[model samples]
Target: MRILEGAGTYVATTSNHWEEHLEVPDLSCGTYSLPAGGTDPQSPHTEDEIYLVTHGRATLWTPSGSAPMGPGDVAFVPAGEEHRFIDIVEDFAVVVVFGPAEYSRAESDTD
Candidate 1:
């Protein structure tokens, strides 16, 4: 088991996203921080994911549509879907969970 103290510490080190494995092999999680007006540079992933907003506000855009997001909001993106956070009104932080653990950019190219 692993315990992380203080989201601020994680937020400080994570410029984009910092991912870590969970106890279960099929699940993984991470935190990302985007300064106001910043954008998420990553593309889509090979595994489904859920984003839990921890701070700030922005609009999550996908091909299907767009929606406003803020603290405590949750968003989901299916595998291979194009999405990004735009028009960041404040410093944004979110916890991302990926299914089939290790399903991030580091592992996507391997498949």
Candidate 2:
């Protein structure tokens, strides 16, 4: 078995956020952290995504609505729903799981 040190390997940027690949099995699982005012590109997902906030606060913006998310908050984004994260605080960290997890994610512009 292997251990992942989340604090050391976390990527940071001024614009888009960073994601470190911990493990992507049939179900994708990893820890994601978003810096203050960071925003992500909009895209349609092939699998459902569950975000469990473990730190700070954030707001998930979708075509449907904007909702506040903080520590202990959980958000489930259904497949095919175009969505993105916004209004991130400096310590926003969450564990994300993408179910079915068959789809591959590339660092391409999902505009």
**Candidate with best TM-score:** 1
Cα RMSDs of all predictions?
3.2, 4.6
Residue by residue across 37-94, what tens digits does model 2's lDDT show? 7766758778788888877778888999999888889899988888877887655777
Candidate 2: residue pairs that collide: none
- Tens digit per residue, CA lDDT, model 1, 38-92: 7688788888888888888889999899999998899999888999999888888
Tell how far residue 48 is off in model 1, in angstroms. 0.5
All candidates' TM-scores?
0.79, 0.72
| Model 1 pairs whose backbones collide | 26-101
- Assess candidate 2 and give its TM-score to the true structure: 0.72
Task: Pick the lDDT winner.
Answer: 1
lDDT of model 1 at residue 69?
96
